[model samples]
Target: MKGVMRFGKKGKLSPRFIGPFDILERMGTLAYRVAFPSNLTEFHNVFHLSMMQKYMSNPSHVLNYEPLQLTPHLSFEEKPTQIRDMQEKRLRNKVIQMVKVKCMNHSKEEATWETATEMRSRYPELFGTF
Candidate 1:
């Protein structure tokens, strides 16, 4: 049997899948989580990268409920400058640090993903408050 197709208002993408990272584009996260709940750190990495990719586009409206921005290109075509390269490098470093702090590490790098999950599970009053 064929199934019926549904769409969002005014031809916009489905809102059921929109979010801080346009979860539609990231359909793999839930599957990964189900497959490997222990790999929360890997999932965290994926989520952070998705978010950074979204922000790198610098969309005009985060609330648009649509994937409206194109991924930013690091280069145009021909010429390259040392200053531009350094700036790009710095931006990448900043993204890594943000992911490490906010999503993955949360402070201590030596802490394995298992340890982090244990902390979250154990200290339901502290980190679990989120």
Candidate 2:
């Protein structure tokens, strides 16, 4: 329930629920032993009931299960695919540049706007030859 890092300063984008794993047994009044997928074997199987939610058994909500491709840190990467747009804003003597980046596995509607300097530094390959 608490392993994942809280994104940004406010934890606004952090995931609320991780899984709907099967409960193996009840450890106590407030604790439960749950079974996790083989891919998530690194994490402990036991969890507090407060950290879990009762999954609604809706057949229509089920999707094809694809085993997650995790990094060493147990996180997935969202690679930048292309720069959709670039813009510059001038304020007095300062000029700020921004770019809309399209990421792999994401749609154009989900493209995020980021500072040009940050994009250049983090993913220089996207810009190519400055």
Candidate 3:
């Protein structure tokens, strides 16, 4: 099941279970009428018993993440913050220079490696006069 895809054409990770929905009433032996939150209005309010799990009062939790400082349209662009490291790869014909750049709103370990020329063209301020 490790390589199985379920979300879409290229979706490797998708939430299989998405609820702690309150059970409104039993609809029969196996089905139950559940109450979905306002945000899940597009989904049906009924589900099978096999699809549910008993709610437990556990302190362990994963908090929801929300991006801050978005524009009026509720979106933010990623910007390069700093240059961490530089390297050159020598091939049979020539050498290719690469740079590791840190971007805004991302952790240090999340920084990505980009070609020096590409990074220069994208954010000239990051590598001033060089």
Candidate 4:
């Protein structure tokens, strides 16, 4: 049997990994947990074409959904801390983007057996023969 794959004009292909699907699955679970307090279902709406594409385009922002908790009463010093946190986040995003570009350029997975052999030598007990 043959499988069909979609490709962009410049030969860019959709992600081969199921990472997007896993993300959507987790998000759907969270949504269900929030909506229904009890007897939650495991089935969740996973990321498809559009949703996955949107997230891949802006992964840093889309993935970071941590809620900020603030008391009904706000202190003046708290605002600056939040601003600093936001700036640090932006800087971290920039660093991630730079590293991603480097990683994308290398389309290779090191040989699994080679790694295992090296591990065996390092920790003989773990990969020892029976």
- Model 2, residue 100: C-alpha shift (Å): 6.1
Clashes of each: 0, 0, 0, 0
Model 1, position 114, has a per-residue lDDT of: 22
TM-score of each: 0.14, 0.54, 0.45, 0.14
RMSD of each: 22.0, 5.8, 8.9, 20.8
lDDT of 2 by residue, 101-128 (tens): 8865445776877789987888899997
* Candidate 4 structure quality by residue, lDDT tens digits, 1-130: 0111232112222223322222322444323112221222332343334434334465455542222222333111111110001111136345211111111211233111223333334444543331
RMSD (CA, angstroms), candidate 3: 8.9
Itemize residue pairs with steric clashes in candidate 1: none
- For residue 37, what is the lDDT in candidate 2? 88
Question: In candidate 1, how many clashes are counted?
Answer: 0
The TM-score leader among the candidates is 2
Cα lDDT tens digits for candidate 1, 1-130: 0111132222212123323433334436332212222212132323333323334555575554333221133111111111111111136345211111121211132221223333344333433233
Q: Which portions of model 2 miss their true places by more than 4 Å? A: 1-14, 64-66, 71-95, 98-113, 124-130
